[model samples]
Target chain A: MSMPALLDLYRVQARMAVQQQLQYRMRNAMVLVGFLTEPVVYLAVWTAVAKENGGSVGGWTSGTLAAYFIVWTLVRSMNVVFTPYGFEWRIRTGQMSASLLRPRHPVHYDLAYFAGSKVVWFVMWLPIAAALALLFRPTLRPEAVEVLVFVVAIVGAYLIRSLLQWLIGMVTFWTTRVGALFEIYMVAELMLSGRLVPMSLMPSWVRDVAGWLPFKWTFGFPIEVLVGDLGTRALLLGLATQAAWIAATAGLLALAWRGAVRRYSAVGN
Target chain B: MRALRLIALHLRVVAMYEMQYRMNFFLQLFQSALATGTGLVVLALVYAQVDELRGWSRPELLVVLGVFTIIGGVLESVVKPNLVRFMEEVADGRLDFVLAKPVDAQLLISIRAVRFWQAVDVLVGAVVLGVGASRLTPRPGALAVLGFAAGLLFAVVILYSFLLILATSAFWFVRVDSFVETFDGVFQAGRWPIGIYPGWLRTGLTVVVPVGFAVTVPAELLTDRSGWVTLAAEAALAAALAGLARLCWRLGLRRYGGASA
Candidate 1:
């Protein structure tokens, strides 16, 4: 298919996904609330930490930390990927057959669903973010160039993290017990992606490792850009690294998709 | 007494089912380790930057985390699995079978599904507590041990009552799963000392949510800061909550029987 055609298909799929999510408003709201809790708690923790440490730690004052976390919440919300736990159930329960019969690839449906769901959640976050900004009185001063760069980086980070997690979810095709693997990945991301704490405060070696991995680019780099920590050189480097990981993971996902489809013996008719 | 034996038997059956999936044991271990590790590393990273957080040293915070994990383990192993199933049963009318049993219906439903694998969380929590204790300057004495035990019991009572109250709401609000999810979200705030939060948040966590009384108060007892009056207050609050939960459960059961009509 031509690039424009594929783009149009994606847009249509996204619209459908959004509508489906709207049908389950209560469930979507609950999930959105669940997603908001983590970032807010971290915001509170770091804000307290910064306040206690003479009002600044690692170039983040309490206000700056609040701004960073508020933005972090929005960025992270948009990037929420459904874990593969449900995928295994789909295969076991014969839902995969229905997906295979669809006109578009199942991944396109998922992508559409993700896009639609985030639109709903992003609306929910705006008021919460505004309330936080008012209460916390965060200091946010970003140049127009920095704002543009941060937006681009945020989109890149979302795609990279989603593709990486989608690849991980693909493991359900091979193993029924991927729960442990998923938990391990979550813990690692919680640590390395600056979900629990900013990478700035981690031990030097830990920060170095985070920089080398795709996880940091997923969360840390985007937040750092918003906070004005990433210089021109680092911004370019971060974007390059994000692109590289996206390409690599996209390739791996395609390969895994082919293998999983070939090995697909439907369970329990 | 016979009811206790029946519950024990039920637990044994569930234990056997869990043991059959040997890989589940490993999964439990991995999950507990990673969860505990993430909390510890976050604490470590924070302390590395600042010597003290709201006057909580690294080891003191570790003790708080240890207690948090231990209480969380107890909730998951005993309370959560059963309460979740009980909620579903109430929704689907399957609870009739449970109610018709010779045993106490509440007791049967509350302890029905035992996830024995969750004991791994308890074991890991104990290890963390041990490691945290080793790093303390003055070792906790017999009195401290006694206080810790009492405090832990009090915390468990609070958690059990909280879950019971939340689960009983299922009878009224059949779609009360989101209530449990909200509770879970609120409980995550307990990972740190409640004192560190702003005054408004501290009040919310302590009275409204009871997150601090579940984990932090017990840790304080072990570390020799908690007074007898505070412990007594927490114990009393737990008892009140439990009593309230029992009353609510009775009321819910009556409604299920169409008694209001």
Candidate 2:
């Protein structure tokens, strides 16, 4: 009963957020272009590269590369957590102090917000993803089981992503240059997260680094699962690795939040 | 000359405003280094797979990346921040003060704010261009250099106008901060040779976003100077686009004043 009631509370908050976001509807609509643009442009460039390479590179054909980026749009939509950028304001404006007084953890609050805000972007991407599938002629032959596993991987990816972001948000307790810091972090993620190109297509060193990093788990793992590239044993290992990272990061996040809240001074001291 | 003087004065004021913040310029320096490093790394990775991407060698693509870096820096330092601020003003009905200025609103909006730190990108781009040019076989001739200068100027004009028109739409839409980011996404295509794209996307980049004229064609001019016709047409298009953006600003202004008058 408690579990069901908690879910209901989250549902109500989601509904409230959806209503609030309506005022910025046009803004969200514009943001959709960016979500679609980054991957499509990369796909086009990679497809051209593949063409020059006699139709394949790093074991990925043009069609398979196309499939990878299409899955990218969905993965990207599910990974919409930009709260780190606003953390400075929350602390500076004394919002964090009020947040600390609340019963549920701040992570739950952030998670609910992320889930709420993503609904529009998620719903809107369906038709665009469909249009891209028809245009790209991707070689997607995933089994139903693989598709289910892809969903689970994506959920795990989202947790790691948001938790890391929340930890970054905690930087406001020490410095006001969070924006600059975030920009630096963003460049690293852009490369490591397989946003720029496929990991297989990247340098061996980059693939090696990203293989052990959490950024790839957020975007790359789900796409690889959808691409149906992993064997059963590899799939289990990848998911296990992802789960391990998520657990580790969640623990780090708890420690950081404790320290951050302790340093929080609502009086601007 | 008057506009130049105004810009010089505005630059100081903007600098003073930005100086109020406790700076970590070194961190920004580090950010630029990381960004440039990552870009070079990506280029290297792509080149590692193939000898060239669509007939553009590593050095030539480095030049393309250089142009992209410069354009992004200029946009961030001047065009983008001001346009975003102008859009916010329009949304909240605070644009009248800027319109009330004696200067041209377009010029005023363009020079409104500057994050001087972004000059790092320009410096990095110049260094990259120099290194890239040093590696070109037979080097570019004097004509190629001249063509590159002309194309780069035109590219700047086209991009400024494009962004101006986009920001002006806030007069109608009233809230379009995210719209600028979409332009940013489109602009990333300029990092590569426009020819590398398929036919439809190539046309879209060239005609729709003008990233072709902005970077690739300029890079081409530097590499070979072979497309005099396209160069001339682009110069013409720059003037035409600048005029269109001026017309858009005027129309939006009229509508704005009428609604808020």
Candidate 3:
């Protein structure tokens, strides 16, 4: 009822969620290792390409490319959301019914779980990233202003990507084969978000379409911010676009949750 | 003869089950189109900045991409999903039923769960290979085709052994899904020619991970550039790995008291 009581409940939930995540330390470590490999491999490939192309391609020097992808690794991992497991398991086992019966909205619990789990992953991943930075000798210019903007963008990107993926996972309420859809989404993210390659290297039309989509803001824009590639106007525009997507996706998630709950209740899952 | 009949029956059952979901066929087609489009676009983007990467031209790299997709399709459609389930079954003790069957348990378990929708990837890969080969210098010859087929078979065997070893770990570890995910992540590096990477990475892909043999060596064969010794080594490695995987599976089953004799 009161704000303080609500905050207390959130705190308690967060602690429990964090404890649950810590129980699977080995699995978490393996996943973090797996996550780190992607960015590292891409960094190597792009570095070679840059070398072969006379030390820079698309305005990024070898060192900047290294910095971009290394930051990309850490930022992307921080924004990683595991909504499918919770969504699918809840739907399959009728745990969602109990959640719906709770006093608070179900998303509160999910958000708490997401935040707590990311806390665990972040602790484990930061050192790995630091080690990579040292080994690769990435030339990083840690601008204080850019760092602040990057932090904000990272938080914004996490919210937007998580909400969107959660909404997609909600489709499990309708179909049993959501895994395929999830895979397709991952492939799209790998391309559009500059996870596979930098957006500047892609065709101009492809870049335009990717920029129009929310996926770019999730990884590409933030990495650009960290790399000092985004000018003043572009940085502001990126933040604005991220905010717009967060709002739009949050609204869609609400509508989808309402419909999904109706389906579950009426059809008796 | 009876094993052939059982395999046929399994195929029929899988086909009947999959045919009910016509939407899946279209969904897989869309997904494969997106995947192929993204790979090609990335390659085009990379080549836009450079004339050659480690002496491989654009068309040569495209050929590599084609083989990678084709091998990936075969693995997903025939080997991966089934062996993944087989690993789960091994954990749950249901693999005993498979072992008790009259047919060869390995063959049965390996081919039992085909997602026929993955045929789209195979078809798309064929088209990509066709286009890529057409763009190659001197064109592909009969020897190249034979080498490509042989290299493909060798690649499939290597991939199968890699997966089996990973899945067989479930017999001991009981939680190998993460290992599979790690494999998937590492395998993404195969999209490029392995020669482009540094020495350590090249060695890891060839000897440790075996992704190079699965995708790159075959592509090299298709381009008619790889030496006979490379093909021979790849085949030898595949055979050795497959034999080792079989031995591990047998030992793992022994631990569960599923030994036949």
User: Which parts of model 3 have CA positions greater than 4 angstroms off?
Assistant: A84-89, A170-188, A229-241, A255-269, B1-5, B257-261
Residue-by-residue lDDT tens digits, candidate 1, A27-122:
767666666667767877787788887888888888788878877887788777656777777777778888887766677667666766777777
Residues B1-261, candidate 2, lDDT per residue (tens digit)?
999999999999977776776354566667777878878988887888889888989999899989988888888778888888888888888888887789887888888788887777888888888899889997998988999989888999999999888888888877677878888878877888888787877888888888765888789889994579878988998999999999998899888953264
- Model 2 reproduces a share of the real contacts of 0.78
Candidate order (DockQ): 2, 1, 3
Worst 10 residues of 2 chain A by lDDT: A260-269
In the range A225-249, model 3's lDDT, one tens digit per residue, is: 9886567788788888899999999
Q: Model 1, residue B131: what's the lDDT? A: 88
Best by DockQ: 2
For each candidate, report what fraction of the true interface contacts it reproduces: 0.45, 0.78, 0.60
lDDT of 2 at B108: 85
lDDT of each: 0.81, 0.83, 0.82
How accurate locally is residue A206 in candidate 3, as Cα lDDT from 0 to 100? 79
DockQ of each: 0.54, 0.70, 0.50
For lDDT, candidate 1 versus 3, the one ahead is: 3
Candidate 2 structure quality by residue, lDDT tens digits, A53-156:
99998888988999999999999889988566678887777777787887777677778777786677777788888989888889989988789889899888
Residue range with the least summed lDDT across 10 consecutive positions in model 3 chain B = B252-261
Each candidate structure's TM-score, on Cα atoms with residue i matched to residue i, is 0.94, 0.94, 0.91
Q: For candidate 2, give the lDDT of residue B184.
A: 82
